[model samples]
Structure formats: C-alpha cells, structure tokens
Target chain A: MWKALLYKEWIKTRWYLLLALLVTLGFAGYALLKLHRAVALMGAGHIWEVMVTRQAVFIDQMQYVPLLAGLALAAVQYLPEMHRKCLKLTLHLPVPALATLGVMLAFGVAVLAVLFGLGIALLAAGARPVLAPELVGNILHAALPWYLAGVAGYLLGAWTILEPTWKRRILCLLMSVLLLRLFFLAPVPRAYGGFLAVLALLSLCAASLSWLSVVRFMAGRQD
Target chain B: MTRFAKLFFWFLVLVLLLWQLPWAVNYLLVQSRNTPFTLYSEVLDDFVMIRHTSDKEVEYRDRAGNEYTRRAFDSLLPLFYARQLTADGRFPDSVAGRPVTLREAQIASFIFRSAPKDLNRPAPGLHFLLESMSGRVDLAMPSDAFRLTGRGIEFIDMAANRIDTAKSGRFTRMLLRKGCRFPVRELSGNPSARKEYDEGYLLLDADGGLFHLKMMQGRPYVRAVELPEGLRLRHLFLTEFRSRRTLAFLTDESHRLHVLTMPGYGIRRVEGVTFDPERESMTIVGTLLDWTVCVDGASAERYYAVSADDFSLLDTLSYPLSERRIPGLSFTSSSDRYVKPRFR
Candidate 1:
C-alpha cells in the first residue's frame, strides 16, 4: 500500500521534481564557478580568508536552498493530490491517513535526498581540499549549531503553510527568522553553555511544530 | 495562536539575530564590555565568551567577555605592525644599527623620529619600536653602522653619517617575505623587522644595559649587556631623566649617574656603556627623558644629554615641555627594545 501511494505521489509530481532538481543543480554549478574564483584569490588553502570572503555567498545558498527545495517538493507532491478527486478515492481505500501521510513524507524525503546528493557531489568534486578529514571535522564540529538553525527554519516553514490562522502563521515565520538570526549574529557568552541550551530549545520547538502541522494536515484533510 | 504559527514566530527571531553574525559582534562590543565571542555558520550561529580579570587572566565567559578581548586585539596588531613598518620605512637602515660588512672598527650615525600607527589603549601605551634584519636596505649600509655581538645591534641614529665605509645618503629596497603557510606577496616600500624590539616584556638598559627576563616560552631569565661608552647604568625610573641620558637631576657624591661602557662590573658589549659612580646614601631613581642620551665625567650629577629633538641642549639636559617632570612625558618602545621618545 505504501509503495502504491508513493507511486501515485510520484506520478503526480515527477515533472516538477525533475525541473526543481535541474534548476538547483544548474544554480549549484554557477555558485561553484564563483567559489572557484574565490579559491584562486585565496591561494593554495587559506581557509580563513576564503571563508571570510565567501561568507555572504555561502550564507545565501544555505539560507534558501534546502528549505526551498523541501517546500517545492511538498507543493508538487501534496497540493495537487489534496485538491484532486483521486485523493478522495485514495483515502477511501484501506490505507490509513497515517500511512498515506507516511508515503507522502517518504516521497518528500526522496526529493530532499536527491538535492543533498547533488550538494555532496559538488563538495566532493570541487571542494576537494576543503573536503579533507580535518575540514570535514570542522563541518561536523559546526553541525550542531547549524542543525538547530535549520530545524528552526524547517518547522517554521511547515507550520506557516499548514496552520489555519494568517496572523499567527506570520508571527511564527517571523519568529523562525529571528531565531535563526539571533543564533547566528547575536554575540552569546561562551561559558555556562546558556546560549546553546536556548538554541536547542528553539530548534526543538521548530521541529515539533513542523511535525504537528504535518499530522494535522493528514488527519484533518482528505481533499 | 495556532501551534504552527508560534513555532514559526520563534524561528524568525532566531534567524534574524543569528544571520548577521559580524554585525551582532559589533553590536555587543558597542553595547557593553560584556559580550561573547561567536563564530557563525548556517548550522551554528553563536559561540563562547571571553573576559579579562583583575588578576590579569583572560577568562572565557559564555557569550560576551571573551569576544571583547579578542575583537579588540585582532584589529589592533596589524595597525601597530603597519605603523612600525611605515615609520621604520621612513628611516634608512643605517639609522638603526646596520651590520658591519667590513672587519675593521667603524662608526655610523644618522637621525630617526617616527610616530605610532594605531592604538589599543591610548597615546602612552601604544608606543612600539621595531628592527628588521632580512632587508638589504639595512644590510647595504656601513660595516659599523651598528656594532653587532651576541648582545644585540648598537650605535643607532645621530647627527652625521660617520661610518668609515659605505657612502652616505644611499638608499635601496628589499622584498620582505613573511613566511605564512599560504604565501602572499605584498609591496614593502620601507619595511623593517622590529617585532621583538617593541613588545613590553623586555627592558634593555642600565650602566650595563640589562633586559628583564620576565616573558619566555620555557625558562625565564633576565639578560644583561653592558652598553657603549658615554652612557650610564642607572635604575629604570626614566621619569626624572626624561630625554637626558646621564643623571643630572639628583646630587649624589658616591652614586654619580654618568653611564659609560668599559668592561664594567656588569657590562656586556660589542660596545656597551657602564655607570659605576656612586654618591653617598644614593640608589638611582627615574629614567631620563627617552629622547635624550647622556654621557658623564665623574659625579652622579654630571652628565650630558644626547637629544633626539632639534632643540640645542647637547651640553645640558632640559625638558622644555616637562619642565623637569617625569610622569607626564611618555616614551615609545620597539616591540622588544626601547626606542628614543620625544615630548608629547
């Protein structure tokens, strides 16, 4: 049943997914070209200078790409299905709302995995020097902080779309942006681990909200 | 009040503040002394804190204090290096004691005066002096521009170019290659290497010039060297003898303050100066004005000031601006060695 639902979802959204993937990879190529110029200016491997100089560019990509991909994937898969007459027929079958929601999520995840694969390929091919174990270690070291930021954005995006209220949804979206900015920009004291704790809490809140939005959408809507 | 809405709202606040990490650091420094030092990434936005304590220890506090110390120092060193490089550039290498290309004894003299580039604290503390070895400009000068031994270089700037060998007024340029892991080519018009010369840890002076051995990588010990002739070995209280090399301020029969370099009791030298004359009931006090170097005959009170300033006071020592005050006047130093200071 899950495989059948996934097949149905793919049938609805394959074209959009393909287009999103193509455009995304195309943009990645353009970005890598820019990064190559920056790398040349940075010499053999002046990591710090390269980082500082390309900070703005990396920031733009990180902020928009993943979640925008996720959103696009979601729209392609679910929005059309929910509004179609076939959605009601699919629901009337023995498949539970949970199972149907699961397949939709799995489809969403597949799209995400493809996008992430492209990013990894770019890193492996172009960022060879920076892709070393130590640099990878650095990226891992920063994983927790950026993970929290991403979760917050993800939840906020999911919630704003699924939530019924206009004003409250806007507020949540604004909160997500604010939380992301604060965690990145605001100078927090290093000791006592207070800042990290707060960021963890915000990240959890975003994730929880996203999960709640998805569950509510599945349970409450057939069309 | 939708559940989804609340979540999104908080995320917005977080991202807004976190994204502008550089600006946020600036804001923290401006807002208060307390702010954490943070490095930004999409995954991780904020970081640890740092602070300075009364005990002179740098402590990493969460989010605030650590950053102030780092941010303040990070922007400060380059300005200092640049200023020292630029000012030192203004000087011919011969002004600072250059190496003797010839084996024979020779004398070289020139004049040097420079101001600091940038400051961390204020006018007085920012003074730094520098010396460079790699440059051909300093090397191309006279053989005896400065008498070099294990002690250090000597016979710095003065009136006329008196080094026996090498023509005066000759200038040249050399490339200063700073060996970083990643190489960068920068144009150096007049660059001198003086990092070790300006840092405040070492004090190189006395009848026999002594450098305090407080700062070290492993073991710590004060290094002592005797200075050249026509100099004094006195206490390091430079306030009293601002600009004047020999002590003329106080009257002591046994503790006479004219320092000359002759294989003294504590003199170490390629050419070092010593001051052994003592007046009854006297321990030396106050450094002479930084600009003035003095030579003495016999008495503690009898010394001549070799002034760096243009005002004629070679036969005597006088602080035209200080009017014989010490604390108000400031002295500039190289990263390691003390350079001559002018009145404020």
Candidate 2:
C-alpha cells in the first residue's frame, strides 16, 4: 500500500523533479565554475585568503535556487490533486487519511533531501581540489541553512496549498513566511550552529500542518 | 493526528507572535540614542565631548558644562589634533612640560577598538603566519596557512591543497619544544601587509599557557610567555601598533584588562578597569601621556583615563543610556553572529 502511494506521487512529480534536479545542479555547477574561474585568474592562494579572512563562500548565487525548487515541487505535486479534487478520493482509499497524507509529505521530503544532498556533494567535491578542508567546511556550513530552508519551504508550501479555505491559506502563508525568516536571520557562516538541529526538527514537525489542511478539506471547509 | 496537528500549528503561531509583536512595537516607538563622542583630555583633566546640536552645529564641551570654540578645542586636545595644529602654524613646541614634535606625537598615537560581535563570531580555524624578518621592506603573506589539531599544528599549502609535512613538522617541533600544548584554545593575529610589521600570533594553549609564535626568514620563532600565578586569560588581542611599546591586550576570567608590554613581555594589570570582551565594546586612544579607554556597555558608556606608562587609573566618567526597549524573544543579537532563541 505504501509502495502504491509512493508510485502515485512519483508518477505525479517525476517530470517536475527532473527539471528541479537539472536546475539545482545547474546552479551548483555555475557556482563551482565561478570559483574555479577565480582560482584560474588569481591563484588559489588568493581564493583561500579571501575565504579565510573575508568569509567569502563563493556559492552565494545558489542560495535561493534550492528554495525555489522546493516551493515549485510542492505546487506541482499537490495543486493538481486539489484542482481535480483527487485528494478526496485519495483520502477515501483503504489507508487512513492521516497515513495517506503522511506518505505524500514523506515522499516530498525524501526527494528534496536527495536533490539538496546531491547539490551539496557536488559543491564539496568540486571545491576540494583547490581549497583546504577548513575552507570547504566553511562553504558547507554557510550553505547548510539555505538547504534547510528548502525542506521547510516544501513542507510549508504543501500546508498552504492543501489548505481548504482561501482566507486560511493566506494565514498559513504569513505564518510560514515568519517561520522561514528564522532560518535566514543571521548571515554569518556557521551562525546556526546547534540551533540548526532544532530548526530541522521544527521543519519536520511542520509536516503535521498539512494534515490540518487535509482534515479541514475532509470537513467540507471552503473559501 | 488531527489534534496533534492543531496543537503544533498553534505552537508555531505563538512563536511567531512572540517574535514579531515586540519587534514591531520596538520598531515603531523606539528612537535611536545619539550619544556624544567622549574622550578624556589630559590638558583639561576632564572628559571632553563632541556632539551635534539640534541647530545642526557641532558643539565641543568639557564635562563641567564649559563649551569651547573649535580652535580652542584643537588647542585643548593638542596630541589628538597635532597635524591640524601644525598645519595651522599654532603647534605647541612642548606638551605637558616635555619636548615634543609632530612626528613623535603621530608615531606615539594609536587607536584600538574591539567589539563583542568580533569576539563572539566564528573563527576560521586556519591562520596566516607572515614572515616577520624577511629583510624586505614590505611584508608579504605566506603561501601556506596553518591549523591547530588535536595532535599538533599542521600547515597546508594553499595552492596545492595538501599538507606540507616537512614544513609542518619543523614548526610543530619548535612549538612543542617551547612547551605549547596541543589544540590551542584561543589564538589572535594581525595578518595584513599594510601594517608596519608583523607580530604573528598569540596562542592560549590547552593548559592555560600563553605562547607567541611568529615566522622569521622562513623559520619559527616561538616563545613561551610566562603567566602570573592563577592568571587564567580568557581573551587576547595582538596589537601591532606603530610605537611597538605593547605586544597584546589580554582579559582574564575576572574581566580585568591586562597589557603585555614589549621588550620584556611583562604582564601588567590595568588598574580599576573591568572589560568583558564578550559583552561590551571598547575603544582606546593612546598617546605618550595617557590613554582614554571607553567601554560601551548596554546601559552606560564608561570612560577611564589611565597613565600610558603604568596603566594606572587617573579618572573616570560615565553616561547612562536611557533606552526604551521592549524585548521578548530574539533569534539574532547585535553582540553575536549566531541564530538561537533568546529571551531577555
């Protein structure tokens, strides 16, 4: 039953996921290309010095790419279900309604993890050649918060999209914006530190928010 | 599941309210404080202030409610405004009954500033050790950087992105021979070519020992600085000032400031001054006569006049800040570079 639900989500989001993968990887590659071009122009020593002294990450261009990918993925996966009123039927399946929504949210979260993980790996592998381990660690630490925001963006995007009433959807969006603002409050590298784990947990708890929308949808709430 | 979801949703709503409501109120109602720039004057024996008046004019005054003209102010702080006084042909031949010159005054003067945010931020573990005695007029940055590990120091060539084992071993041996424990707790250095010269780094080791490490002609110059008994230092600032009279400024666990003087590395406690480098911002204007040290705190800004020779407290002044703040929940702070839930 879980496999069937997973297959349904995959079939729905497969094409969009492909595009997201490419766009995210393309942005990551472009950032790496710029880093290497800097190294080629002014020796690797210059890059390392800047990264050390000035807190230059060299991947700031890709900061918002993951966020957009997550938001878009949520829309592609859930908007169609709502437009066609297929969520009603999906909830009426043999599985419990909460379990069904849980599977859907889990699928979105998993795919986002894979996508963001690949982007981070690509950055680290590309940066390892011309940078020391410390510099590479600095770059990764700076990017960690942005990637976490992508996960939160997907979950909150689903919560907003699955909300039954238009007025309530706006409220959910306002809350999400404030909550996401927490992820970007500090610009310094490694500023999140241990707070990142707390943020990740809160982001996962946001998965339950989509269930609230599903319950409202089942109760016949409307705009 | 529905009940849990509803509870979680309300929790998030409460968090946002606590975070945003106070911020919005403070933004709407709070006015920024315009504190005067205060400095202690040896000639006046009082704190002098420079402030902007409501009529869009600059006012210079002493703490005793005495205002002075701009030229009079320049004459009062002759050391601070020496260049201007010299250019105007009104420079004093001697100050404080000692023979002085514009060159001596300029070389003896330096400004040192440290903020809480600078000390509270994350440190990039790698450090550059420039050649201190390369026989060249201008110092150049080294091709490699070093990191302190659990075992010893490791130097990595930046271009090759690999460890230079031979060079690393040589420095590691010297540091070990100098009795520096592994994994430095805190290290400070000024690593720019624009400075007069390099003084390398001041390292606090695991055993609460202080060591001075620098590179001279591609070799290591490590000195184990002896600390006074039970003097556990919490922070260090390596000052490469033009006069070269002092090597670094240190703060101990009791928040008392200490100065490490040059030629002998003698650690002298600056009397009657307490500066917590983690919470307050401090600025010091030094001359051959005295230093005007300003410690800006959350509630008040305190000024101390200390003798440059012995760092003994001469006088003190303070101005209390009347800040109208509505603090509830804050994730970011002006004093730190971290994002964490803090309530004040």
Candidate 3:
C-alpha cells in the first residue's frame, strides 16, 4: 500500500520534478559559467582573492532558483488534486488519511532533497578546482539558507494549496510569506550559520502544517 | 491533531507579531543622533567641536563654551584643517609655543577608526603574504594564499591550484623557530595593495600569544610579540597608516584600547577609557601634540582627549544621545556581521 501510494505521488510529480531539476541546475550552471568567465578574464588567483578578501559568493545568481522550483513542485503536486477533488479519493484509500498525507509529503521532500543535493554537489565540484577548501565551504554555506528556503517554500505551498477554503488559504499565505522572509533576512555570506540548524529543523517541522489543512478539509470546513 | 495544529498556527502568529510590532514602531519613530565633529586643540588645551545649530547653521565652540569663528576654528585645529588654514594664510608659525610646519603636522597626524562589525566577523581562513620588500613604489597582490592548520601554515598557489609545499615549509619553519603555536586563533591584516605600506598580519596563536608574520625578500620574517603583564588581547587592527607611528591598534580583554608602537613593539594603553570592539565604534584623530579619541556607545558619544606622546588622558567630554526607538527582536544588527536572533 505504501509502495503504491509512493508510486502515485511519483506519477503525479515526476514530470514537474524533472522540470524543477533542469531549471535549478540551469541556474546553478549559469552561476558556475559566470565564475568561469571571472577566472578567464582575471586569473583564478584574482577570483580567489576577491572571494577571500571581499566575501564575494559567485553563486548569488542561483539564490532564488531553489525557492521557485520548490513553490512550483508544491503547486504541481497539490493544485491538481484540490482542483479535481481527487484528494478525497486519495484520503479514502485503505491507509489512514494522516499517514497518506505523510507519505505524500515524504515523497515530495525526498525528491527535493535529491534535487537540492545535486545543486550543492555541482557547486562544490565546480568551485573545488580553482579555490581553496575554505572558499568552497564559504560558497556552500552561502547557498545553504537559500536551499532551505526552497524546502520551506515547498512545504508552505503545500500547506496553502491543500487548505479547504479561500479565507484560511489567505491566512496561511500571509504566514508563509513572513516565514519565507526569515530565510533571506541577511545578505552577508554565512551570516545564517548559527541559526541554520534551527531553521532547517523548523522547515522540516513545517511539513506538519499541511496536516492542519488536511484536517480542515476532512472536517469539511469551507468558507 | 487539530488542536495541536491550531496551537501551532497561533504560535507562529504570536512570533510574527512579536518580531514585527516593535520593529515597525521603532522604524517609524527612531530619531537620529546629533553628534558633533570633535577634535582636541593643543593650542587651546581644550576640545573643539563643530556642530550644526537647530537652525542648521554651523557653530564652532570649545569645551569652555567659548564660540569661535570658522577661521578661528580652522586655526585652532590647524593640523586637521591644514589646507583651509594654508589657504587663509592663517597657518601658524607655531602652536603651543612650539614651532611647527604643515609638513611636520601632516607627518605626525593620523586617523584610526575601529568598528564592531569588523571585529565581530568571521575570518576567511586564507591570507595573502605579499612581498614586504617588493622594491616597487606600489604594492602588488600575491598569487598565493596561506591558511594556518594544526601542524603549520600551508600556502596554496592559485595558478597551480595546489599547496606550494616549499614556500609553506619555509614560512612554517620560521614561525616554529619563533615559538609560534599551531593553529592561530585570530589574525588581522589589510591585504589590499592600495595601502601605503604592508605590515603583513598580526596573529593570535592557539595559546593566545601574539605573533607578527611578513614575507620579506622571498623569506619569512616572523616575530613573536611579548604581551604586557595581565593583558589578554581580544582584537587587533593592523594600522599601516602613513604616519607609521604604530604597528596596530589593539583591544585587551578588559576592553581597554592600546597602541602597539613600532620600532620597539611596545604596547601603550590609551588611558581613562574602555572600548569594547565587539559593541562600540571608536575613532582616534591624533596630531603631534594630542589625540582625541571618540567612543560611540549605546547611549552617548564619549570623547577622550589624550596626549599623543604618552596616551595619557588630557581632557574628556561627552554628549548624551537620546534615540527614541522602541527596541524589539532583530536577527540582523549594525554592530555585528552575524545573523542571529537578538532582542533589545
């Protein structure tokens, strides 16, 4: 039953996942290309010096790519279910409704983890050859909050889209925006170091928020 | 489950309100500090201030409340307003009964500023060792960088994108011979080539001992500086100012500002004041006679005028600054480079 449920989620989000991967990876690749251009124009040593002395993170262009991808994934996975009332049938399966929702969220999160992991891996690989390990770590640290924002965006999008009524969805959205704003508060690289672990935990905890929407949907709460 | 979810939602709402309400109030009503531009006048033996009046007119006054004309003010702070004094033909033949020249004033004067954000930031773990005696009029940025590890300093040659073991060994051996502990704690240097001179870096070693490292003529010149008794240095700013009177401006754990003088590497505390580099901003305007040090604090701007030769407090003044702000929760601060939640 779990396998079938996971398969159903895969069937629903597979194309969207591929598109998200391509878009994010394209942005990441573009950032790498810019770094390459920097190295070509003014030697790799110059690039290293700028990064070290000036705190220049070349991957800033990819900051919002993960966020947009996450938002899109949530929309792709949940909007159709809500639009066609297919979520009712999904909940009516043999498995418990909460478990069903959990499995679906788990699937989305799993796929996003892989996608974000790939983005970070590409960044690390591209930066390693020309830069020192400290610089590579700095670049990675700079991108961590943005990647976490992507995950938050997905979870918040799910929470809002799965909500039963218009009025409640608006409330959910205001809260989501405020929460998403937290991830982008500071422009300094690695400024979010001490807070990131708590933030990531909060992002993962946010997955439970969708269950509130699900419970409201189950209770037939409508505007 | 519904109850828990409902509780969580309200909790988030409360958090948002707590964060935003005070910030909004503070943002809308916060008043700017009307701090004056102040400097010590050795001729008057008093602090001079140039400030804007309520009508937005410039007013020059001494600490004794004696008003001065703009020309008088320039003459009083001759070293500071040297060009203006020269243009007005009011450049004095002597100040404080000592014969002085514009060139002498320029060479003896220097301004040093230290901010909290610069001291309370993350280190990049990499440093460039420029050739201290490159024989060029202008300094050049190095092609390699070094990082201190548990064992020794490792230089990474950027062109080859690998560790330059030979150069690394040379530096590491020099530091080791000077009895520098492995894995330095905090290091400070101005690596930019735009500066007048390069003093390399002042590093605090693992055991809290101080050391200076520089590359001179393709060889490592390392020296371990002996700390003054009971002084544990917390922050260091390598000041290679044109005057070159001091090696660095440092703060000890007691929050006292000290000047690391050159030639002998002697440390002299700037008496009668405390400056926490992690919280306050400090500005020092020094001339041949006296130095005026201004410490910007949370509630007031404190001024301490000291003798430049001895760093003894000559005079002191302060302006109580009242900023009408409703303090609240904030994750970002002007006083720091880190992003973490803080409340005030």
Candidate 4:
C-alpha cells in the first residue's frame, strides 16, 4: 500500500523532481567553472586539485549539495497541500497510513540519494590516486545528519501550514529548533537513537496528516 | 507534540551534532599535555645550546619511561660563578680580597627535569645548562658563539628592566669570577663558527645582572659528559611586544615558539612599547638590531617593516629560504635565513 502511495506522490511531483535535477545540474556547471579557475590558480601540483575532476558525472554531482535543494522543493509544495486538506482525497483510499508515509519519505530520500551518488562518483574520479582512506568514513558519517535535516525541515514546514491552530504550529517550529540545538551539543555527529526518534516522528505526522486529508476530501465529496 | 513535530525536532539536533565532533577532539589533546607540565616562569635566553647524549653507556630514566636524549651548549666559554654575600663578603674557593669563583666551568646543561616524572613514561631529555646557585645567581655569558667561553653562575639582579638591557647600568653585585677572562676579541673565521658555538641562555637586569637560566654542565671544552640526574625542565612561555622591524624567531623548526620577552628572549605579558594617543601611530626605538616600527600602540604581529626614510624593507635577508611567516608570532627579530646571528 505504501508503495502505491509512494508512486502516487511521485506521479504528482515527478515534473518538479525533474526541475530539481536540472537546477542541480546548472549549479554544478557554475561550481565546475569555479573549480577550473581555482585549479588553474593552484597549478598542477596543488593539493586541492584533487577536488576538481573533469568527468561529466562528477560535474553533474556538484549540483547535489546534500539535501538543501530537496527540502526547498518539498517545503514549497508538499507541506501546503497536506496542511490545507488536499492530502485528504488521497489518504481516503485503501492505504495503510504508516506504509503510505514510509513510501513518501523513501521517495524523497531516494531522489536525494541519486543526487548524492552522482557527487560521490565525481569526487572518486577526481581523487584517482592519493585519496585519503578517512574520506569515505567522513562522507558516510556526514549523510546521516544531512538527510535528517532536509526531510525534517520539509515535513515541519508542511505540518505547520496544515495545522489549524497557530499554537501547534509555533510549538512545532520551536521543537524543531530546540532539537537542532541539542544535536549540535551532542558528542556524536551521527547518533542512531536521535535518527530513529526523528524518523518515527516524521512518519507519524505523515500518517496523521494523510488521515486528515482523506477525511476532509470525503466530507467534500458528500457535500 | 504530533508525529511531524517530533521528527522535525530530532532531525535538527542530529545535524548540529555532526558539526561539533571535531571541536571535542582538539580539546582532549591540549588537556593531556598539561598533565605533565605547568607554567612556572617566563624564561627565554639569547641562544639554546644542545648536545645529544643518546650514545652514552648509562642513561638516567625519569618516572615517565619516555627515552629522551640530552642537549647542551657547544660553547666552552668560562661562565662566571658568584657567591652569595655574607658579612665577610666571601664564599667558596676564593683568594683573599678577590671575588669568589663559586661557579665552575660548565660545558653542558639541562634546565627542565632531567629525571623522568614517572617510571612508566619515558621522557625525552633536553641538555640545556642549569644548576642550583647558593643564594648567588649563575650567568653563562659566552662572549661569542665560536669561543664558547663564559662566567658560570655569575649573579642575579632581581630588578631586571624589561626595557633597555644592551647599555651598561649598575646591576646588583654578585661575586663575578674575575680573572684573565678575555672579552672574546676574535670569532672563528669558520662560518657559523659562532652559530656552531652553542651559548647558554641568560636572564639579565637593566644593570647587566643575570639570573633565571639553563646551561650544560661540563669542562670548558669537553665533547660529552654524564647527563644530569632528574634536572627540572621549565615550560617555555610565549610573550608579546611591539617592534619596529622584524624580530628573529627561533631557528629550531623542530621546536615551537614558547615565549617572547621584551629586551630579552621571552615574551612576558608586559607591553614593550608605549604610544601617545594623539600621534595615532607608534615607533619602538632600538638599542640593538631592531628599529622602532610604526604601529598602533603595542602589538605582536607580522608586519612588512618599511624603512621610514626610504620605505625599503630593512631586514629581508634574514628570513630563511622557503620561510615567509612565523606561526603565532609573539616576538621576532632580524631573521637568520640569509645572515647568521652575529652573536651566534
């Protein structure tokens, strides 16, 4: 059921997804030009030259700066629809709320992953020989936090607009900010417990909002 | 809070935590080094003499099992040894009516603890010269680098002027081993004959009294000797002062800048130059190689020192090849990159 909902979300937003990709590619072009000039300035023997590669895929991945672009798109589109009752029409169908929410989140995450994969491929191509072994570990560690912030920010923005009461919206906003503060203070960059907690909450909200959207849609249909 | 709110909250925290991991690692490293070290005095001498003692048959171990080799001044210049003044004005081996020669001719020294603080931790030993003075201070003043001659444990003038030291003034009297000690008339034609001659460090008063130091212990010309047992190594501190032209930093790249003193080697917290608020500029007068620089009051930084008359760089030759700036520059002097220290 979640698969169907995930597909449904994709069908509605696929064009936006394409737009996001193009925007990323354009950003990559700009980054590539900058890298070329920087490399030229550093000359052939500069240590930072490894960061700039000529491979097409590598250039393409520069468009992907973790999840910043993804969240921006989602915030402008998904949150408003659910908060304003547009999601009700879809949730009324025979779908497990949790499954549907999971698919939607995965769909978002997968799109983000594609963006990231392209960048890693390019960076790998650039670092042909003298790649530091620790780079992989650091990049892996970095992804956890990037994904969390991107998805969480989008969801929060959507939920705030959907909620009827101003207090709940304010509370949600404050909570997100508070959580961000605590994370910075924590010892580990990637705390598994924290990730799980965030995932559970985001999934739960998606379910609740889907139900609300479905109920409102049905009421409109009867009228 | 609703499910969406919870997710948003947690995600925010995770992102912030990732940014903070690197900071924790740095703090841990500094704390560890502090365990075996503490700041005692702001000590800096003109030159640090070093001699390697690893080849010796018997090596002393500190409480820490760290294996450290010893170092000492290569110079064999006779050092002045002063005796504390009694009512009779005499101490140690002395001729009647003559100054007491309490200090012996020293060849090597270790200022810090020669002994390991712990048995398990093997510490590397530094062979800078220093020993106890019987109420009188010791001065290891080598006339020039090549000659390696000095007066050991000469005397201490407690009221040292942080301002002017090159000129002569009445320093408190401690018995100076007066003898046929020659003012080094000629340095070795051997290039860096002076540099190769490791001079002991000294703390001097405005009146030329000396105190607070480290020197190697040995005969005036001996090549090696037994490393001292459990010598106390003091932590060198970094100091700040204003300068007109560039001040030479430590030549030992293997070592870092630990202290900068005004008119001496270390930097005390004291500001070395003063300025009038109305002038809106500053200049430091030099009794030695440095010129008074134009600056904003007292500052310790790297500036392109231009000659006020011609605006040409005054001390460009002293920088070593491939060196541009000193890290955490506290005090600097004319460089040694091209020209070696005249005193060295």
The candidate maximizing TM-score is: 2
If scored against the real structure, what TM-score would every candidate get? 0.37, 0.98, 0.97, 0.35
Q: Which stretches of candidate 4 lie over 4 Å from their true place?
A: A25-29, A44-67, A127-148, A177-223, B1-344
- Stretches of model 3 off by over 4 angstroms after superposition: none
For model 2 the interface RMSD, in Å, equals 1.1
Docking level for model 4? incorrect
- On residues B1-344, what C-alpha lDDT tens digit does candidate 3 reach at each position? 66766777787787788788998888878766778899988878888898998899999998788899987788888888876888888888988888889888888888888888886777778889888998998999998998989999999999778999999999999999999988888888989889888999998988889999999888999989999888899888998977788999888888988989988899999899789888999998888888899999988899999987899998899999877777677878888888888888
Interface C-alpha root-mean-square deviation of candidate 4: 21.8
Quantify all predictions' global Cα lDDT against the true fold: 0.35, 0.91, 0.88, 0.33
- lDDT ranking from best candidate downward: 2, 3, 1, 4
Most DockQ-accurate candidate: 2
Candidate 2 or 4, higher DockQ? 2
DockQ of prediction 3: 0.65
| Pairs that clash in candidate 2 | none
Per-residue lDDT tens digits of candidate 3, residues A65-132? 88988999999999999999999999999989989999989988899999999999999998888778
- Could you report the DockQ of all the candidates, in the order they appear? 0.07, 0.86, 0.65, 0.01
List model 2 lDDT by residue over B268-311, tens digit each: 99988999999999999998788999999888988999988899
